[model samples]
Target: MPALKSVTDATFVDEVLLAAGPVLVDFWAPWCRPCRAVSPVVEQFAARNRGKITVVKLNADENRETTGTYGVKTIPTLMLFRSCREVSSIVGAPSRKALEAKLREML
Candidate 1:
């Protein structure tokens, strides 16, 4: 299974913006219960779409710049970035299947 890569404020541009395929940025905080609930679903999506899409996790508490710039007011927001631009997002804990369905629309 493909693992989730951690991204920091410093590496956000290089990791997400520069990526060729769609990048799913999981903006989450460690203390968020909903974020913890969504973690596994994000991981499974990463593994399933290993080559087609790149999944990266950013801790909102640690990486304030990227999180704040994106206007993420929620802890478990999943933003879909394509060609260095924001395409769409889901802002809560969602089942793996549901997440994948919405992500497929982005792809």
Candidate 2:
């Protein structure tokens, strides 16, 4: 299974923006219930799309800079970045099928 790499304000630029392929960034906080709820779905999506896209998590609480830059006002926000720009975003904890459908559209 592919594991989600944790990205911080310091590494966000290189890890997400400069990545060679599409990246799915999960902006979450440890204390967020919704974030916890969506964790498994995100993990499953990452594992299934391992070679097609890169998946990373950014703690909104700890990575304030990147969170602010992206205007992430909510936890469990999923952003799809392509060619250094945000191509799509999902702001809530969506079901596996819903999330996959949305991401498939974006990809």
Best lDDT among the predictions, by candidate number: 2
Clashing residue pairs in all predictions, respectively, total: 0, 0
lDDT by candidate, in order shown: 0.87, 0.89
Q: Tens digit of lDDT per residue, candidate 1, span 1-107?
A: 55588999999999999987889999998899989888887787788778898889999999888888999998799999988999999998777788778877866
TM-score of each: 0.90, 0.92
Candidate 2, residues 72-93: lDDT per residue as tens digits? 9988999999999998899988
List runs of model 2 lying over 4 Å from the truth: none
Candidate 1 segments exceeding 4 Å error: 95-97
Error of 2 at 70 (Å): 0.5
Q: By TM-score, how accurate is candidate 1?
A: 0.90
